[model samples]
Target: MKILLVAASAALLGLASVGAASAYDGTNCRAPGNCWEPKPGYPDQVAGSKYDPQHDPMELNKQSESISGMEARNAQRVAHFKKTGEFVYDVKKIPAE
Candidate 1:
């Protein structure tokens, strides 16, 4: 009976450790409308973290615009290639200096 009790206690301790290990931290805020933003008066380390979207809204907008433009250009290129089995290139004729 003592051997069985010891075994049961060990098993319970192992299960408890596993449960603690599997607990989640709230760092993953990637769902829709769940983006993390910096809060005022927080610790500098937490406030200045890399994932905060409210740091520079204009920079984010500029980056988004650049990406959108690149994607649009890529889509146009793909459509052109599909229509005419040839790739497109901009061959600028450099003036003889």
Candidate 2:
């Protein structure tokens, strides 16, 4: 019984820690239209982060707003997928420039 209890607790802790590595803070979504696309398994939004480059709408002002912005943002998202092997959400934490 004792061993079983310990094993269960350890397993639960491990599972909880797995998805906690990468998280969005939600501070980026302050603007009116700001938002983020959530990954399949990760949480939709973090407490203090928003405007994830991966999932957020990046281009607002442009000649062809729909076409150009989408193309550029999609290209960037694809590149990110290649590097991380996972899709980024709109609430993604931006890396330091």
Top candidate when judged by TM-score against the true structure: 1
Task: Give per-residue lDDT, candidate 2, residue 17.
Answer: 84
Residue pairs clashing in model 1 are none
Clashes of each: 0, 12
Which runs in model 1 stand beyond 4 Å of their true positions?
1-45, 48-54, 91-97
Model 2 lowest lDDT segment of ten: 88-97
* lDDT digits (tens) for residues 16-56 of candidate 2: 88767545555456565676555656655664455444544
The Cα RMSD of model 2 versus the native structure comes to 21.6
User: Which residue runs does candidate 2 get wrong by more than 4 Å?
Assistant: 1-63, 91-97
Candidate 2 shows a clash count of: 12
